[model samples]
Target: MDDQRRIFLATASRLGALAALTSASATGRAQNRDGGHAYPFSLGVASGSPLPDAVIIWTRILHDPLNAAATPRLAFSVRWEMAEDEQFRRIVAKGAASAAPELAHSVHVDVTGLRPDRWYWYRFMLGDAVSPVGRTRTVPAASGMPKQLKLAVASCQHWEFGTYAAHRHIAAAAPDLVAFLGDYIYEWGPYQLRHPKSAVRASESFTLADYRARYAQYKTDANLQAAHHAAPWIVTWDDHEVANDYGNEQDERLDPRFLQRRAAAYQAFYEHMPLRLTPRDFAHLRIYQRYDWGKLARFHVLDDRQYRADLACPPPGRGGSNSVQPRTCPALTDLGRGMLGREQEQWLAQGLSSSPARWNILAQQTLMAQNSQLPVVKEGDGRFWTDGWDGYPAARRKLMDTLHTSRASNPLVLSGDVHSFFACELARNPSRPASPDNPLLATEFCGTSITSPSRPQTRTEQYVSMNHGIKYGRSDKRGYMLLTITPSDTSAHFLVLDNVHDDASPIARAAAFVVRDGRAGPVRA
Candidate 1:
């Protein structure tokens, strides 16, 4: 036997009687008659970070997902296989990874040496238990130009509010990639508030175990799992992943122990994701990165939560977001304040300046276009929401300047977390309508949350009317955005669920917009 296979066998032998009880059929599906242990792959399998010749496939060996203490302390050998076909007959790559209890027994296998721009099926095995098979594909080679790209963008799934019917539909669409723009799991839960009989946790997650259990509970949802299994995902976090409206090291409550809580949450996030980088000290995780879809598109996925300044002019003793009149709040105009921090801002500028792709996609959390609560007919009439881009006007202006000066080709910003679908023309000053002097610089399609509730539709209408650049806004529905990108143009479809309370709810296109090549704004399609 080869050294790798021999080593894998030696490690598998450590499972002792359990490994001996393992058996498989012709398709490599584990058939374990062993009744001594609970199933290990209850959380399902996923793949992400698709490079030209590599993708990260992940799974966690959880006997009792709700309780991290149930996992044994010993290291376990996990076997993974990738094939060109659903059946294992054409296995292209196979490897073994060690799932230690330190990372909650999670396995992240960065499989490489595969052909680019091709679909593959992968699964994980831990002794007698086998994970669900997942479908993934690598991006086209860096220099190669592809004709089209289909992408599904989604975010803000609060487990208690509604069902993940949107994710179910996303899986059905089978987009080339899934970009999760954050709030994968809310930091707190009152299970009885919405779904009275639900078994999810009823408190906030503050420790490592709590965070892990929360993630486990969310993963139990089959629709979300199906979405993960359908395509390679690119993910970034928003506030809810740690605490609602949290910025930098401060939570809404301004607890002195907030950083410790954040560390636990960050570690849990890393453990559950199929990411390329590992967290440093469980406190800092550099999630902002770039991905190229051949020469067709360049995705600049960003992290806006970790390094942002705290919400300007928060209520006394509170550190989270609030609504404030920019004219009255002097701190709102701080030129030094930034939403993406200094380093990330520079990196983004550099990327935008150097990218040669036909489309430049800024996949981020929350809306980028300015949305004032009141009409901006005069200087002091506008009321801005402190949680989004309006909170950092200087930074937003800087980003818009970069897009303009860099002359980034067909710049498109995809955002979420507001729980509303918004189509807007990004301009130097979004308060006023686009014109010859202050022209549109890019297009933005901010999708609604998967299940999170939104403000009333009437209020959304008012905001749309007040924000001249916003071509469309809808807060009544909950869903995701589907993007079809080509050399000539990019189309966005706002797909909404009829009933988020029902897991099998039907979905429909609520709106559609198209941005043609070399154009700066989206027009109704």
Candidate 2:
């Protein structure tokens, strides 16, 4: 066996031994929740960061999810088990992890030494309360190419706007993997204009405690919890997780204490997420990473918000995004200004160049293709939104150049955060038609939000009419994208809900597109 495989097996064996030693004591502690304490698994059980032989299962012990003070300062011993069946008749792996108050009483157990390409059921125990059974699966073996992979892409769920009916449908679909491309929770809440009756939080999240409580409130949704239990997730956050339209360390308000606020937000995100790595400190957390789905696909998950330059030429006093014409905003073409920053851009270049997978998927936030608000009969006439790829045209060109130079196979980008569904073609110059000289580099499908409201559908239609590269656009729907990847082609279905306000809304496919293997653009399927 390889050295890496051997080391993983050895670590798994050591963990197994340790679990055996603590099983009796842990079980005893679990039988009586520290003398009648409230049930701890209120938020839910989740598993993520899946590998061929391992997956990270997570849960936070919270007697009262909204009130952090309700949790004891002492560490709680949480036992977890993984089995091949829902009944857990044949236990495959068992372990115990400490739910420490320092980490918000969260438990993360990296369960390893399992076969690839199959489903496993897992759960956590605290006192006599057992968490909802979660189902997760490992990817295919490194050298193996699976026949297919079904992925559901979703994001931008504003709680008060509507119920999470989209997530309910996603759980019912039971995809192989779920990719959440940012805005897991809106930093602000209780708009009052939306559903004032069902407000989770009355104020915006600005501190660690506030962020934690906000996450707790969102996690209380049964549909969201069901989605977590349905499949393993791969997540990346965007602006709203910290503050809307914030890039790097700067908030839209340009608050002097933005970094401190960012630090708190980052900590709370770590405490709640099913991530593999812990943040080094409150000041910095690296969320950009890659995941391989066997030899079929490689997911280059990005962190565009944390390392990007401030939005170009915000209105004189404002610090957030604004629509502007390129003729008036020369800074829009600054070559030094970057979306992924230098280091991450270099890393992505290397990954795409060396990737052996058949499909290289860029799982990121926002749209990559050019979307001019006005008609672009000529270059300078088009008005662009400064919040997305249009804000950094040179950086977009650099990324397109990398894709062309590296020749990444079947490059497809999955995006969210615009609260709209968009199917577009990526090229060096998206305003122009794709020709031999100006070839397509990748295909993009940007999903609409789970519950968040978007602009009117007429505006989307206008933008689609103006932008030649955008094959489809729809802002009226609220839902997720279902992608089916095979050796031959990748089919994407834009699934939408009949009513976001209804908890039991019916879901239907709004559109469908397909990108053939080795092709770089999507077509109506």
Candidate 3:
């Protein structure tokens, strides 16, 4: 095997042993596509970005490359079926697609003509062998407004983090949709010890192959695939997908000479994920888009790193992963400042105004809160604005104002990154003195990292006490947040995972929060 492929496989095998020690995600069965085991399912089929009649189904043809070194690109004629019953005796849609070697033998068949807002089960068959069964569904078609919407917003699932305990818990709950806000993969040194993989992928992935190989390793995780198999996902990236704290058109780890890695990462991101392939390639990368869930929600997904200014503090630094909570100050106003550039902002503003969706959801990867430590602590208290909206105060204010002026029926911001859980009320005019009338224009729920370590709760509580604007905070848990929305009310199900490495983890509680329509703020339940 080539060095790259060997590393990827060896890493999975090595970590597989340790990963079993703590992860509930690995509990399904000793079935992997590696061929040494029964290899029960082909990473189970998944569908995402649902439309009235179409949902994209994805699966990879896994073969024993070790037995046939030349067959790294596994190929097979695969058949998929979506049915109203567990048995295909009552099939709704069926089709044939070839998982060709050029695409790493992965299949992305966009299936159309299915009922909307209804349940369906699906699976893939390769020859006489069938894959694991998974369930997925579409949203209400346009003009239809259903009552409740359940979405699970998650991010930062590092591979070695004890078996995707968070993913298993999410699957058990069976949310309607999963919004993966970012940090889907960490592309750096010092990967968490919890990662089951033996050694990490290249620390600086700058080529299409590097990115693809990285994703292949991540997708091999049973817990991750289960989450995908269980429900369609709404994914948006925050650093780590490409590189840490990366801003638009910049490199976090690459030297000036190796910037071409960006194209590599972008293209690989496309090939591995369930995302569709297009003939067009912007320097060999594909990302950035939005999705709407009927009138109940209109999700405006943003790529924070695609177009951002580098972090300002500790000068001459690339923004990513540096000081997950960076330094703050004058650098916050650099003219190059921007979280979401002009075009994106305008598009979002336009979408917010034109769309009739009752809820305007900005699904992003950073904190929108303007927090500056009072009686300022050390040089970098992780408050530096360069890494997030704080880096561009003017731009953040504009976005906040647009939501305020548009009077979006209910504006809610869901984000990942910052590695903790935060619930806050956004003030269009935070500058205004605290008053009942200084109405909060929007609500923000920052989900904790899916598996990333949060700063200890003790320190976080101390910081929260000092920073009043931060309504609540918790930094020492490896879990995700669940969001339940209704036309008249939106509540967050802050689902907590007991142990990331445990074989049978339990979800602690569904900490609830409610936002009354038009009131524009979340109240603790």
Best by lDDT: 1
Clash count of each predicted structure? 0, 1, 21
Better of 1 and 3 by lDDT: 1
Better of 1 and 2 by lDDT: 1
TM-score of decoy 1: 0.92
Show pairs that collide, candidate 2.
30-127
Tens-digit lDDT track for model 3 on 340-417?
Answer: 766777788888888788888999988887555342344444453357666666677778789977767788999788
Off by over 4 Å in 3: 1-42, 64-75, 188-206, 276-279, 282-286, 317-329, 374-385, 429-438
For candidate 3, what is the lDDT?
Answer: 0.67
List the candidates' TM-scores in order.
0.92, 0.92, 0.84
- Candidate 2: Cα lDDT at 73: 91
Model 2, range 164-195, lDDT digits (tens) per residue?
Answer: 88887787776889999999988878522223
Query: For residues 423-513, could you state the per-residue lDDT of candidate 1 as single tens digits?
Result: 9999998777789989999999999999888999999998887788898999999999999999999999999999988877999999999
At residue 365, give the lDDT of candidate 1. Answer: 96
* TM accuracy, model 3: 0.84
